[model samples]
Target chain A: MLSDIAFLFYFFSLFISFIGSCIMFSKIEIAFKWIGILLIVTFLNELNTRFLVKSLSIQSNGVYHFFVPIEFSIYTIIFATFINLKRWNKILILLVFLLVIIEILNTLFLQPIYVTNTNTMIIESVFLVLLSLILYIRIKESTYYKNLLLEGVFWFNSSILFYYAFNILVWGFHNWDFINPPLIMYDINAFLCGLMYLTFLFSIYLNFIQVRKLKN
Target chain B: MTNRQIESIDVIVFIVAGILVILLMFGFILYFLISYKSKKRDYNLLEIQKKELDDQKKLLENTLSELRATQSQLIHSEKMASLGQLTAGIAHEIQNPLNFVNNFSDVSKELLTEMREDIKKNNIEDALELASDVVNNLDKIYFHGKKAESIVKGMLQHSRAAKGLLEKADINLLCDESIRLAYHGMKSKFMDFNVEITTIFAQNIPKIYIIPQDIGRVILNILSNAFYATIQKSKKISSDYKPNVTIKTLYDSSGVNVYIRDNGCGIPQEIKDKIFQPFFTTKISGQGTGLGLSICYDIINSHGGRISFESKEREFTEFNIFLPNKSNLVVKIPNNVV
Candidate 1:
């Protein structure tokens, strides 16, 4: 029953994100559109992994290995748009793409595909938090000082920061199996996912409102 | 993997991640606050610079207008001084003509009385001769009277404040009249003063478009300076000193040129450039206002013309005034004449 409730909460968040993206699709900037697309992709990834694991009784570790690196690349690209340094932005995107490629190769050949890629996930989470931190610093030092509360990207990065920062512990404990797992842990995990999607919904909606205000 | 190993790894990872998050959060907050403070400081500095620029612009505008007002005041003062000096010469010039008219009238009166006496004695031929003599004497009186009237008319024209308006002026006549007025002026001011004046006016010189009154003042100014210089030279050298001023007017396709040369104490090379500057004079403090040449230069320059001088110290000085016949005027001489 609790798993069913967690599933409902996760899908509910995704539905909200879908509505937010649709609302802003025609009016938002290119960078902002990429963010909406990323939200849809995340929802699809979660749906596919759940279907394969529950119905087919197949492990979703391989799916995660493939999806994780791509997600990192997309997030890096989204943040790169926020960076004002022209040459450095391209360099940073290229560096992150190369790193993702290396991690995928390591997972396919060196590590077993059946096992959870816990160590790599922890590294990815830490790296993502670092990138979000870099973005925070850049925004602070910018000459075109925007109010952090008004900016969609600020909230988006902050969501990324909090999610990855706390998820590092979950990745570390992925191998553990207690006799009776604490129900609260699963609920907390669902709550974190819900928070991330809600943040996405809010950011996309804010972008739509801002664009409309500018048009008027 | 054993639950013991997994739990141990989780404990270590959680501690590291927690510490890193705490440090990053602190750093980000600190940096944001500092950047905000710096941005506020930069905005304040920019505002101060903008205000300073506005103040500087206002100061420059005030100074420019004050300079313009002072310039017109100086020109007016110089014009008045020139008029005052010409008044003395006009008075002296009219005196000779009036004396001749008076003498001729008295002689004609005597001849008329003699004609009446001869007619009473029946001397008809003698009476007719006396009548002819009286008529000649009356003609003399009429000629002198007209001469005095012309002098007064010329002086009136000179005395009027200049309009500085360009017109088709006979350049030769203008120069001759200025020379006469200037020479008579110096003679009236100093009784013992005498200078040999020579004028070579080009005949049929095309009428040059000019501000006659302004150019007339310029001509008078240069002539007076030339006369004054020669007078000084004459006083210094007792022997072989013949004060002479020669004026020549020439014309070409380009323009009309007037040359006023004098045998005088020439301009020293050291002070040559300073001559055209306002308030610079070689004369004793009270004798000269020192604005003569500067005003002459300004007047010529305003008419799209130029005034320059060539001089050898203690020998001779020649001033050349060239007026272009072109219509493009650089300076807008005001039409209001006071």
Candidate 2:
């Protein structure tokens, strides 16, 4: 029953993100297009993980593993677009290319189709944590002296940094075979994702207000 | 270390570092919020300071207007002080014209009676001659009446508080008028006063632009002081000691120059510097408003001119004035103000 509520909350957050993305599409345009695409892919992945695991008798674990590398790569591209630091940004792109090659090799041999790709997920979570740190630094060092609470970039960077940091911890616990991870782990994962998506919606709203102020 | 132990350490390090980074980001955001609130407070304070400055500016404007009011009051007081001298001078000066009028009226009355008698006796030639004599007396009477009217008019102009404009004026005429007014005015007060006033006027001096009334006031003020000093000295001196005031006017390439010298009690050394200060008077209170010399100094400075004096105590005092020849008026002088 708890799992069911987690699932419902996850879909509710996705619905909110979808509405926010549609609003942003009509307004600020291309800045959020990639993020919207990422959310759509995540929504499809969640749907498949819920239904396909039982009905089609297909391994949803393999699908989750397969999609994780692609998601991380897409995140890299989005960060590259946002970050003005050309040197670090190019290195992040190179890292994405290397990560994709490694992921392909892991899926074919080390982690077969039925197995959970905990190793790759852990690696992706680590990279997300570091990248989120870099993004936070960029927001902090910015000369924007206006209200930080109202700043969309500040909120977005904070939400991502918080989620991925916890994500690294959860995936790391899965890596250690001896440790019996708590049942609440799944709930935490669902709640964190929901909260992250809700923050994204908030960021979009802030951007809209700022853009309207500028135009008027 | 074993491979398993190394893997565990790696997981531990990643989890710890991730938590630390999140904590640091939260710290940065809190700092930003606090800083922004403080800046808003400072901006509000700056707005209040601007409002206070505007209020102070209004207060200063009010003070400046009050200062102007005080200056006009001072000018009025100086005019009142000179009024007494002006009335006394008018009395002494009008006596000559009045005597002429009286004598001419008597002569005309006798001539009219003789002409009537001649007409009654049928002597037409004598009656015609008597009629011509009566007409001559009437003309003299008219002339004397006009002269008396002019004396009253000149005195009225001097006594009235007039903020008159600058114009082309003969400096010598101003000095002569001042000497007449001051000497007569002094004589009326002294009763038995007699003084020698010698004028050495230069020929064909071109009229310079000046505020005729203000310059008149300056000359009258100086002449009155000179006469007062002389009268005071005369009372203490022997019978042979004759008080003399010599007025000389000359013009050269530089400008017009006026010299008013008095062989009176010269200004004492101790009081010379204080003479031109407002309300600095040696006379008992109510006898004078000591704004006279200060007003004179301001008037000359405004005209782009200068006035200076030289004196030896109990010997002589000479005041020298220089008016510019060029049209370099600091204050604009208009025309026909007299």
Candidate 3:
């Protein structure tokens, strides 16, 4: 029953984020609309993870298999950089588009259909860390953009950090149980992903509100 | 792990998320309230300042109008003083001639009475000659006395105090009367010049609320300037370019506009602006006191009006006077009532 309530909260958050995206599209400004689109996509991706887990009967290993940490990390870095270095919008746009293409390719082709290997996880985790570092650098340099973008980066990066650290701990020190664990690490991952998507949605909403104020 | 343990963990996470969301919402509400309060305070301050500014403007306008009225009163007083002096001199001049007419007419009456008595007693020859002589003396007294009386009457009318008795007066009647009075007064002093006066009065002008005599004086002053300009120009140019003065009246949204234009050697552009200043004149020394246009300016301003002029050297000069209409009921009030 409690798990069902958490699922409901996650779904409610997704609904709000989707409505916020629609508001951005209704606005005339291109920058706000694009940021809103990015938030909706990230939320949808997170929602799909939960749906796949339930409908496909994807166990813990299946959960880790299909979802790539690299995608969120890259988006976080690109959005943070875009907010910070708007003067280089043309170059940043090109770079982000290329990274998205690479992410799609890797997700579709590189990893096996049902593998949960530590090597594959570490490789994806390293790319995420690199992306997080770039995002952190942008947040450090920007003054006005720091507060909002930093909140998004903090949620996403901390989630990635916790997931990777816990994984490493469980694999290296603790007895590996195939069926169940001492802690609900999967639930924690789900909660953190929900938080990351919520923060991203809030940041996009903030951008749209600021643009609307300027237009008025 | 039991199902109870999983439920407990889920409850803890859910409670924490709910608390965080409530806290964030509270913070946003607080921010909005503070911003709205500050903006309302700023708007109130601006409204107060605007009200204060409007009050100050009204006060300033009142003071300015009062100052103008006082200035005109001073000018009127000065005019009265000068007119009083002229009146004394004119009265003395007319008195001598009048006394001679009166004394001669009395003597002629006595002579005719004696002649009638002699004719009744049958002294025909002496009575006839005496009667003819009495008749000739009566004719002389009648002609001279009538002439002197007309001159004195004209002088009295010209020098009358301007009580500023505002009334609905016809502009054409006022203009013609003023020009006639001014010509009668000044023509004898300045000889050998035929000044052409033309009136281009607009037909069907509504009766304007103004002091007829005061406005007449203003027109007379402008005409005097035109005549002076013509005299000055005649010295340099041929007599063929005959001097002409024109008075025109028109009405529009801005009330009645009177234009007094002259084709005399126009005022120099440099001195044109100064012409309306008190005691500023281009006339030769001792010929003019130079208070004319200044008085005109004061009169028009007191009527809630303005006077402006345009002049081109040796071409033409035009003075435009704009007077507000009856809609300005406050200004239309008589001075005594106000």
Candidate 4:
């Protein structure tokens, strides 16, 4: 059942990513480029998870466990920095860089305090919540892409928040009875993230319309 | 998933997306460059057409001025030909009187000699009667001969043929002569009505190259209009009120300006625009040809100068003429070079 769920997730992500790519190809604006890039990255990550589940044995001790948080942190920081660099201050750049370096160092050097599946899930959830909060603040203050960009950020942040909260509650408290129903929660995140990508693409199209109107 | 697998997937996606973005950006830049170049070409074409149109307008104005000058020369030649015919008629009329003066003078001289011989023989009554007849015949010959000579002289001056030749001439003297010539024709009609003529001439105006006859004609036309306007107004008002006309001239750095003004029945606005048009007259049938102002307009235009007027109905009218000082020399230079 876990392998089947992983395959479905992988295919679903690929389908969403394909649609995002077509949107990017259609004379879209600059902001959507970032959203498209993020969607493709997530799709690849899901596909990799699907492959791992198919080829390898099901085990709590996975070699990729330590790399996930480090990879997530690096990608999020890079994307956020690129989009917000026009508003960049030296202090903000230094703070975000410091946080990324610390996360990387922790993933590379720190040993596990306790051997449990819950600990890994708890750490990942906490990091996702922190990243979502930062992204929400950045998106709220931005004026260039306006309502559509804000809608995108709202969907993306809420999806991440819900996923993290659901995971933490499901694993940290050992709530095994609700596990089957909550598996669908991951799909909900995927759907919401797809909607976020679509809204971001529409916002770019709107910007193009505005530019054409001004020229005439 | 293994860390190496995840890292490979991320690198592949990044590379693909980056390539797509670079290609799209290049396409946009190319489109913008093409649009900009076409807009610039359109602006340049519009500018060139505007310059060509301005050149055409200037050429048309020059052609119009030349046509006006040619027309005026033709009219002046026609007037001169008619004047020559009139002069020949006057000469024929004087010839008959002139012959009698010559024949009678000779006959009277012979009679005087015979009477002188008779007087020497002491015939007192016969000598007295013959002496009275000789005195009477001498008076007739002197009076008739002098009258014919004065008439010829007046005809010669009125013809203005000698004055038409270019010479260093005073404009003030020319104005006075033209006024005298016009008054000869106008005085009889205005004799019973009170009319005053005044002249204010400017001194030391440099001699200008012109045909004095043509200038004389312009002065005559303006003075005629002034007299007629005044006469018409006086008839409407009290008979005792005297009409006044003033002629004045001024010389400046640019040119000379002549003004003829009168306290008269001023031209109405409706007729003012048509005043210089040929055959457009306010006079009754057979009273005026209406070619006077039209001819004046043509003459001034040919001289590379202008004539204009101002009038307030029932109050006053002023005709202003400006003739450039060196216009003849300036105009000839261009023709000579071309």
Best candidate per lDDT, number?
A: 1
Q: After superposition, how far is residue B265 of candidate 3 from its true place, in Å?
A: 11
DockQ, Cα level, model 1: 0.12
Per-chain TM-score, chain A, candidate 4: 0.53
lDDT of 1 by residue, B150-263 (tens): 888766666676655567889898888788778888887878888898989878589877878778888999999998999888888886888989999888888988999999
Q: What TM-score does candidate 4 reach?
A: 0.35
RMSD of 1: 9.1
Q: Candidate 4: give its CA RMSD in angstroms.
A: 17.6
- Clash pairs detected, candidate 1: none
Tens digit per residue, CA lDDT, model 3, A74-122: 4544554544665545544555555555544544676344545444454
Candidate 2, residues B106-162, lDDT tens digits: the string is 888898888899999999999999888888888888888898898777767665644
Ranking of predictions according to lDDT? 1, 2, 3, 4
- Give the Å error, residue B92, model 4: 20
Lowest summed-lDDT stretch of 10 residues in model 1 chain B? B329-338
Residue B158 alpha-carbon offset, candidate 1, angstroms:
4.7
Candidate 4 error regions (>4 Å) = A1-14, A19-38, A52-188, A197-216, B1-198, B207-228, B238-242, B250-259, B266-338
- DockQ for all models, in order? 0.12, 0.13, 0.02, 0.01
* lDDT (C-alpha, whole model) for all candidates: 0.78, 0.76, 0.62, 0.60
Candidate 2 vs candidate 3: the TM-score winner is: 2
Which TM-score values does chain B get in all models? Answer: 0.76, 0.78, 0.54, 0.53
* Alpha carbon lDDT at B318, candidate 2: 91
